[model samples]
Target: MQTLVQTFMERRGDLLTALWQHLGISMASLVIAMMLAIPLAIWAARRPKWAEGLLQLTSVLQTIPSLALLGLLIPLVGIGTVPAVIALVIYALLPIFQNTYLGISEIDASIEEAADAFGMSRMRKLFKVELPIAMPQIISGIRTALVLIIGTATLAALIGAGGLGTFIMLGIDRNNTPLLLIGAISSALLAILLSALVRWFQTAKPKRALTVFGVILVLLAGGGAYSAYANRVETVTIAGKLGSEPEILINMYKDLIEANDSHVKVTLKPNFGKTTFLFSALQHDQIDIYPEFTGSVLETLVKGTNPKGMTAKQTYALAKQRLAKQEQMTLLKPMKYNNTYALAVTKQFKQQHHLKTIGDLTRIEGVLKPGMTLEFIDRNDGMKGLKKAYHLNTTAKSMEPALRYQAINDGRVNLVDAYSTDSELRQYNLALLTDNQHFFPTYQGAPLMKADFAKRHPQIVRALNRLAGQISETDMQEMNYDVNVKKQSAATVAHRYLVQHGLLKGAK
Candidate 1:
């Protein structure tokens, strides 16, 4: 509990910013849902025939899984706040719409008759009597919608929409219990707070309720305006895949780029889905720069055939050429580390089988049950190519990245494809088999950017290039260990690396 509290305190600034983003997305979604739903509900209440169909449509939307809804919105709206808000609005509609219809329709018809008998117009009666009488039920619906929005907004982080979800995802990725607790607790509290606020509005006097609503509107508007302004001022947007190393590299790029030119404002958008998403984002101009691997681009993105027995330098050069010619992207100078996939085994298994290289795997044949990530299982350059190149006929099971090491450790699996920089290699005493056949291409880490962005920001390029050959495989593994095993934040680990290397000065 104390550790969680301390973590929250230390990350208060980031948490507050996340909170603001959460509130902004939820409130904007609620407002939009209310605008559309209330009117539709009012129309349905007035005409009993349309109510069933309207409710059915909204119910269908509500039934869609939140994650699926977010995915569905991505191509239409792109990622980040827009798609997130749109999904939330869709999720919020059924409750508010149903309740509004119920509230207004359940009112005593006699009272409405009396207002009509007293010569009051339909709108006047609605304002003076029906709405006020229905206010409590309407407020109840709003409360439900608000709570739902607050909870669901946590998923916005997956789509690069900033929120408390950022910490939650980071915590999961890095195995930081305290950070996860903080994000979960903060989100729960925000939901409770919003629920209470709505309840207060439900019971409060008319003037007080109106004032509270007004204040909320002002806050939402102000937050939206501020976010828009901040985005406008940010000169470079850097994105990265969802992992410790990518997070560290993106932060490094952000820090170095900003330090190189104070006028250049860098926005760090970490955890932007997968490598394919990053490539798409860069192509579409959604992101300016992101760290990528030569092997990944050469084998996957550009669909280029790996030259047999090509040196690491040759692989990088080919990737650079292909990226520029085919995609109009540029690969910057690569770091010393290569994070390519390699087949690994527990030290016990390695010793028992006397396995020193992938060539040795062919001797074991069907005896070795290999576990690999789903991507690697399907990737052309992964297990498929490995089998063809080495003539090994072992069937590999697709496993989650985080669980693969444990599988090997527990003897559930004998071998697994692992990244070169995976900390588990050290922690679990795993041995990487030498790729004597060299089926996997070299994956030297480098910054991939839009050619136009690189051309426009020469200084940023120079600043990033300064990092080339500086970070070694050992350095990357240690940093990953710091975040994953030691429970250190990625930002802290990244900043320490920069300072130790003299790449960044002054306390951040």
Candidate 2:
């Protein structure tokens, strides 16, 4: 508990930034939802026949899984804050809409008669009587929507929208319990505070209520204007996949770029789901640069490309050519390490089966059950191609990268697909099964950047390229171990590496 507190205190600045981001996204989403839902609810409340269908439609939207909904929106709206805010607004609609409809519809018919008797106009009656009486229910609906948005906003990080979810996802990837707890607890506290604030607003005097809302409006307008201005500035945005390696690499890029160049700023949108997500983000100019592997680019992104028998250099060259031609993206210098996908088994399991190669899995056949990440399970160059090459038949299940090691160790699964640079392979006493069939290609790590950005920022590119041949396989494995097994932060390990390599001066 003390460690957790210390961790929170150490990262308080980041937490506060995430908190502000969370508030902005959530509040903006709730405000939009209320605007749309209130009008729709009023329309529905007047039409008895339409109310049921309208309510059911929103209820159905609420039923879609939050992550699934975010994924679905990516292709349509692309990644980042827009899709996140849109998804949150969609999720928040049902509660607010239903409450508003109920509040207005349940009003006494005699009140309408009283308003008519007083020669009140329809709009005047709605504003003067119906809305005023419905204020409490409307406020209650807003409170519910606020809490819902706050909780769901954590998921916005998956799509590269900054929020407290960034810490939670980072903690999970690195297996740091303190970081995870901080993100979870802080988010809960924010929700609680916001809920209390809304309730207070419900009961507060008119002057106080107006003042609070006035302040919120001012803040919102200011935030929106600042965001607009920031977007126009010449900033290099680096994105990364969801793991310690990408996080480390992106941070290294940020540090190097900022150190070398005073005119431009570098920012990170870390943990942006998968390779496809990052690729899409780059192609759409949602991100300026991100670390990618040659093998993944060849096998997954560029469809129907056969990379068999290609050397690492050939693969890198091919990836560079193809990405430049197709996506207007350029691959920078490759790192020394090949963080390729490989199968691994517990030492005891390996000993029991005498499995030395991926082909040896054929001997175990029916006895082998493999667990891997979803991308590995579905990729053409992953299990599917490996199985065809080795002529092996085995049951495989899709699991998260973070859980695969534990599942293998616990005997829930016998074999697991792992990254060659993962630290857990050593800590868990696992043995890598060699790819004797040569099904999987070498994954040389490199930064994929927008061609225009590269052309404009040559010095920044030069600064990043200085790291090209520096990080060996052992260096990456040790860094991963430090983060995953030793529970060190990725930023700390990255900083140490930068300083040790003399890549940065006075890195603390």
**Top lDDT model:** 2
User: Each candidate: RMSD to true structure?
Assistant: 3.4, 2.0
Instruction: Give each model's whole-structure lDDT.
Output: 0.86, 0.88
User: What's the CA error at residue 407 for candidate 1, in Å?
Assistant: 5.9
Q: Across residues 1-508, which tens digit of lDDT does each residue of candidate 1 receive?
A: 8888888788899889989888888888998999999988988998888999998999999999987887677767677888899999999999999999999999988997899999998899888998889888888888889989998999998887889888888776665788788889989999999899888877788899899899888987887788788778657889888888898999899888888988988888887766766776677677889999988988789955677777889988999999999998899999999898998988888899888999998888868888888789888789888878888887888876777777888889988998999888898899999988777878899999988888988999999998898898999999999877887777889989999889889886
RMSD of 1: 3.4
CA error at residue 279 for candidate 2, angstroms: 1.7
Clashing pairs in 2: none
TM-score of each: 0.87, 0.95
Candidate 1 off by > 4 Å: 47-49, 106-120, 227-234, 303-310, 349-378, 383-416, 434-437, 489-492, 495-508
Task: Write down the lDDT that model 2 would get.
Answer: 0.88
